[model samples]
Target: MPARLFAVVFGVLLTPSFLLGQVGGDRLIARISRDDANGDGKLTEAEFTGPRRLFETLDGDGDGVLVIEEAAARLAKVRSNVAKAIENRSEEMGNQSQREAIRRRLQETRGGARARVEPDHENIRYGDHERHVFDVYLAETEADEPAPCMIWIHGGGFRRGDKSEGGLFARSFTENGIHYVTLNYRLSQHAIAPACFEDCARALQTIRYNADKWNIDKTRIAIGGGSAGAGLSQWIAFTPDRADPLADDPVLRESTRVSGIILLNAQTSYDYRWIQEHVPGEAWKGDGLQQLFGYDVDRLDEISDAKFELIEECSPLNHLTADDPPMMLFYRRSSDPEIAEKNAMDGIHHPIFGTELKKKADQLGVGCEVFSVENENDMRVYNQRWTMAVDFLKRQFESVQ
Candidate 1:
């Protein structure tokens, strides 16, 4: 896990303390309860069907449903897989702190699943790419009452991130009776610019198209994630429907409207012009924005008008309109003096991103709440409002009128 996620999810720094070590059985159940569709302690056929053979082999009674032991076994398998994945990430992800943090999490899950929060459905493909996979974590909602859903995208500066990190958000939202989804999209290295954002849009449509099967209330859906994920959530949420209404495919016909959005330190704009105007001299890091849009500053003189329009279209700030959904953005509070002392591009976490978006939302009469560590209880770094964000999302779902 990245420090951002470890801190946000565990309510503790991903330092030597390793808060994940405290994970236990009940806590694990709370993580994966989203698919507990009936709020019961068992897994039904409607709620689970792992890689087929495993689920079938575990079905001792020839009945499709699984008891707690079976469910725990399935959950344990998920943890083991996740542990191995994180182990690989620790070695290959290129960040020292992130690598060490993932190593700690790897050790925790490898010790044995402390929490039985497993993906009821894993690696369900939304597109042909190897990275276009998703995991479903169901909430324990009443049989007749469909639950709202939130899709989580991981933050990795657009090049690296895992769908498995929805552990904290999955537990938080599913415990509150909201279905959760975490997905992997193609990275900038594989496909740049709009491709990743389009994958998210496609995933939302695919998920909503199968809403009836998943027991999701398609009308009450939201999109969010951390950093890059948050930015793409805003991209999808704020933009008009990517649906091709005339297309033959049913999935492409689904609208991408989200009732609410949750953003954690997301970029306000990907346009380099905005970066130049907003980022302070000391904090300016050409590489951060360059990595996403794939245009070097030195070559601006050679860029074309069509490319410029496409860049503007990719910027979340440019897409905001009155029709955009409710949004609650969280960031760490900082003083002007502190901003100067920060490392390059750390300013992306500064309040300016949230405040500027809030300004536009206020102008359009949209519901936008910008919270920072200084005033908002949920905005603290180590102890983020994982539950409060869900509450805000549900309120947005309920308040749709």
Candidate 2:
């Protein structure tokens, strides 16, 4: 009787793995190797100990047993394991199904999984002091007409993020007959204000210089990004003719005239005081922003208010004008009480759209549209926002026509 209980429990625990192994032992082994609790590269003694107990229960009627009750219990445990394996496989199938759907749709309209636009990389020096290179995504979108173009910047605060981050966005735009470009710039930690902006401008010039080969539509060009990239995108959108003409390159003569803007959870402006008042915590403190201006926020007074002047220069809000491109801002609301329950720190730092930023866009008559995402994970919201961006661009192009 004592060994019978152990066998029953052992059978219950062992049956699941044995069952799963029959169906997809290789897959089960792979997942176990990756996420196993003990990390012994294989299931450890502690892991198998419970299964051993279940196996013992399968030896009932205790005359060194092999009875009907023990066999029935083992069979039931095997069934349970089989059910669990099916459930896990079903989940994997679902993800594969989604990817196939997206791929099929893309093939129906555009070409295969390959990016529609051919990408090119080149190294170039911008200004006398700052030297950086950029990558260009291009295609002969039209035979006779000039295709609309977009310069896509990536976001990872000002410290991180790269140009070739999202192939999906590039493919989406290109498939819809829009040409686009993406480039890398000097990061914030290494250089101060205007260096990123300057590098971006130079990259634009390089593209324009070779525009003939790329078949760029110079008259209809736009810039866009998310987060810090959105901030930079917004800055370039509104600040027309900000590029220096005195620079050696003719590309600098070209204007950054985007007809519309798309921003996602972007820091619209860098007011440490504003961020501090609303955002709470030292995460958005001035020290980080101060680094952009080569000064410490604490030392701002001694530096003759240079911090404030730098703030003005770097703030996207300061660059906004009545003629700025139409703006679409997507943010979130804090309606979920369970946010903290799900995660302690994430619940605290969840981004909320500021009212004043929306008001500023409205005041400028910038064709601003603001929306809030609720009750869903951010990845879902990101998909929705990408659709909105596509729609927004379509409408903007249509209105111009």
Among all candidates shown, the one with the greatest TM-score: 1
Off by over 4 Å in 2: 1-131, 243-248, 286-290, 297-303, 332-355, 377-381
lDDT of 1 by residue, 1-401 (tens): 56455343343222223335535435544544555665544554446533443333333222233455545664566455554655566454565675466555554543321232588888988899999899999888898889999898887668665786565457778878889999999988897788998999999999999999889999999888877788889999889987788989999999999899988766778776776577654433545456666777777788688778878998899989998888887764452535534433345556677788898999999899877655434333414456568778878878863
- Model 1 CA deviation exceeding 4 Å by range: 1-116, 282-284, 333-341, 375-384
Local error of candidate 2 at residue 221 (angstroms): 1.1
- Per-residue lDDT for 312-333 in model 2, tens only? 6766777778877787776543
Least well predicted 10-residue stretch by lDDT in candidate 1 = 10-19
TM-score per candidate, chains pooled: 0.70, 0.63
Error of 1 at 136 (Å): 0.6
Most accurate candidate by lDDT: 1
